[model samples]
Target: MFFSLIFSLCCVTAWALPQYQPQYYSFSPTVGRGHGESFASVGEGRITGVRIWEQSNSYIKGFQLKYENVWTPIYGSTSNEETELLLFEGEAIVQISGKYNPPNYIYCLRFVTSRGRSLIAGQPTGNSFNFYPVDGQSELQIVSGRSDGTGIASIGAHWALIYRNDSKALT
Candidate 1:
């Protein structure tokens, strides 16, 4: 039983990151600082890890990834949704399937401060989009399903990233 448990854990750990690609190349226009660098993901539970860094020197302030429902993701086990993380603020969210249709779900992240206060926010972008969460800030979005909610495999979104324009900032 112990061996089996260990083996299962190892296997699970290995099957975390999504095999798909990324879908957007947008940065925060309001960010008075760095540009996003890259991401690292391993699709495990209902959520994965994405690393977004500081443009100046890749000082990662946060990352984005999907949360795998663990018990049953999509059709059975392979369907998982994306989640975003704002490390600077220590915030995260999971996409829960909504009661709507085709792809009925939303992305939300919440965290508390050392002082003690609930912080939660939803992903403004759909499966794929060119969005700016806060004006003058960096832009991050997803790109996998249609505008309405049809899923499509796009490598462009699997591991896609956009660098900051040193000469031309978003603002």
Candidate 2:
């Protein structure tokens, strides 16, 4: 009976646990100005991860992610790093707008997936931001202008996407 109980508990634990297969995607590199705006789209799926990268010494002040018409704000400082999320799905729009110190810093946004592979919709360039749609995914837009206040400046920007084969399927 003890052996049976142990087996049952193990089975329950396994069933309740979730499998993580991490995938990542990013927007193309572009120059951002103070108060300038950049937009990228997260394909339809479960978003289990997020990350921000500042290729240069400059930093981004603030940003936002819009999903289903809800705006989720993300703030940054002198350091560029990654941020984790529980699980988010549906269509997402990332809008990064803020001041970039040093005027010509480089930056990029990365999105990780929990299940299924990431479809790369853009590629990074040294001087320009280009979108290379995969699976017919939408293009990422990085614009320079004032959204809330005076825009900041950046040297370049890029997008990267990562996909894992072992992640659980998105429901």
Candidate 3:
């Protein structure tokens, strides 16, 4: 009787407590040829800057992202004109849209932030594609894709809720 009473109390307590569901990241469909070459800039911290190298009136040649104070290695080779965007405090990238060419190569990229600011690079040619979080509560967290030796071949985005150093939610 004692053991049954204890077991019943435990089960009731467990069932009464609130269940916390784990948050999973949502991935946007990758766009472009997606050759074997690969690169990833995952969640290190808040994104602080973005630099894109592109041929004049042509495709994206290289890309780099700054996480917190660190910069990821350049994906693809760096040559020709380069465009850079430095984000302000608490700003987050909320949308990504671009164009991809046949065979390979990302033709253009436009990044929109939560503050309504934007950064655009490359030429607006090729097929159009867009990426953003469907969960509404998440922001851009991971940028992964393939890059040919000379230019970006494909790109994908991952979105998740932002967390502070204390593990508190920021978004």
Candidate 4:
């Protein structure tokens, strides 16, 4: 009887304690129109590089992400200039900042990595936004958003740890 009482108390105590929930992912609020468009880099692999096509003095035209060795299809149209950022081993994107005009159109973007390296593109001329991991233990795992045929109209980011595989490590 005493053991049963003790077990009940233990169960109650445990139940009353805060549950530890592991965060698998966190998402930054979608910035821009975020309509009629979608792209995701999640579940493909770790992001090894970023490519942004931008019209000089204007909005971001399109972008693509390199997952390990493979590059995803560009989300928008190619433009006058293209900027690419390659991430070093053990590095991950931790922050993304950008500007978006009213209605639609992402004007500029900046990607900051864990190693303090940053890649900036497009023309900075609109409402500004900053995105980072909410849990602080995650990195950029997914890049999804909307794009008009001509340019990027909206964007969002998902944060989480990438699945590790030594063979697929970036060159």
Q: For each candidate, give its TM-score against the true structure.
A: 0.17, 0.27, 0.86, 0.81
For candidate 4, lDDT tens digit of each residue in 7-96?
Answer: 999999999999997876998988898665576654466777998999888999998888778898888889769999999887778899
Candidate 4 colliding pairs: none
lDDT of 4 at 97: 99
Task: Give me the runs in candidate 3 sitting further than 4 Å from their true place.
Answer: 1-4, 7-18, 22-24, 165-171
lDDT of 1 by residue, 1-171 (tens): 999999999989889856685444343221111112222233542222232222122111222344333221221011223233322222222121111111332232233222233333334333332223232232223322212112211111222222444442222
Clashes, model 4 = 0
Rank by TM-score, highest first: 3, 4, 2, 1
The digit string of per-residue lDDT tens for model 3 on 1-171 reads 999999999999999999997664799989999696888885488787889999888899988888888898888878769889988777778899999986879999998888888889999989999999887767788888998798999999998877665443432
Model 1 worst lDDT run, 10 consecutive residues? 93-102
lDDT of each: 0.28, 0.35, 0.85, 0.84
Ranking 1 against 2 by lDDT, winner: 2
Best by TM-score: 3
Q: Which ranges of candidate 4 are over 4 A from the true structure?
A: 1-19, 163-171
Runs in model 2 with CA error above 4 Å?
Answer: 22-30, 36-126, 131-171
- For model 2, give the 10-residue run with minimal summed lDDT: 143-152
User: Candidate 3 clashing pairs?
Assistant: none
